[model samples]
Target: MTTTDLLNVRSLSFAYERRRIVDLWSERFDAGLVWLRGPNGVGKSTRLKLLAGALAPQYGSATLNGKVDLLTDPLAWRREVAWVSAEPPPFEHLSPAELFGFLAGLYPRADRARWELHIEGFGLAPFLRQPLRQLSTGTQHKAALAAALALGTTVLLLDEPLNALDEASLVHWRACMAQAAASPDRLMLVVSHEELGVTPTRELILKP
Candidate 1:
């Protein structure tokens, strides 16, 4: 395994009540941009959840950094990976800055400058003070993405990152993703139906 290889899976299999999803999979995910594209209900989110340690596989095994089991140490595992979903979770009364600050507290070494930069980059500066419940879907998504990106983890698992964004915001998101992908220590796994705009180093399609 190379230094760039971050995730290693062997004979991985996952199923829901005997209905197989991921089957006999063995793959090495290196530090780079990887796109997982497939039709709806084809297990894209399921595969990502497994990789992110949100779900345990029924069979086989996966190791992060060669030895750590995601299931055994989920919090520690999450420190190495970040998940960004298409549907922004209900933020309710929390302000964007407040929410960001809360997430920042999780990482003592988090870069404040980078966090502010993302806030501004996403055009979320104006709405920072407004309650997240008051923001539009696109703005809410931006805030969520900003918070996740600010965590500065090694792996980013994004599901339909472009959803609900306008054309200009989409452009900005593409640029942001491109910069994240440029880091040799960073690995981005995106699940999307539309063209990702940025060129991915590898593409994997799940079949039903």
Candidate 2:
């Protein structure tokens, strides 16, 4: 396996309060955009959380770069993988500019220049100085997305990425994902309910 074979989940099991969600799930993730599709109650979000190491697996293992464990190697795992959810963590008091500066410190190797480009492309400059709570839902979402895109991680896990964007922004974001996936060293796993016009390298459907 090469760098493209960065994420591997083997015999993974996850349960929520004794209710099994993912059982004995195993798969190898390769570079490129992989659309993770499934019906509403099939644990798509849960699976992404497991893969992102936001939630620990009840059993089995998830490996990053073929060696780093998602459970025991959190810090190392986060450095190479970026997770973006539909509703991002609250930053009500912080402006987009302020929030980006704060989060950028965590990823030392993140591309500041590219981050700026995302901000411009997403048309977030107008609201960049306003508090997040004051911005529209779509603007706030774009701010969060800008941070994730700026991270320059090897693996990107995006949940409902097209949630609140306007038509123009939607087109721009699709281009962004497409451009990022063009790199052979990067892997973008996205969970979307509708087609956003960008073609996925592959699609994996999880049936309940």
Tens digits of per-residue lDDT for model 2, 7-113: 88888999999999999999998788888999998988888888877888989888877778877788888788888876754667999888878877877677878
Best-performing candidate as measured by TM-score: 2
The runs of at least 3 residues in candidate 2 whose Cα sits more than 4 Å from the true structure, single-residue gaps closed, are 1-4
Report the lDDT tens digits of candidate 1 across residue range 58-173: 87776676656576677777777778766665456898898888777875556678878888788889999999999998898888888878788877888888889888778788
RMSD in Å for all candidates: 2.0, 1.6
| Prediction 1 TM-score vs. true | 0.89
Which residue pairs in candidate 2 have backbone atoms (N, alpha carbon, C) closer than 3 angstroms, thus clashing?
A: none
Q: Candidate 1 — which pairs collide?
A: none
Q: Return model 2's CA RMSD, one decimal.
A: 1.6
- State model 2's lDDT: 0.84
TM-scores for every predicted model: 0.89, 0.94
Q: After superposition, how far is residue 157 of candidate 2 from its true place, in Å?
A: 0.8
Poorest 10 consecutive residues by lDDT, candidate 1: 83-92
lDDT of 1 at 80: 75
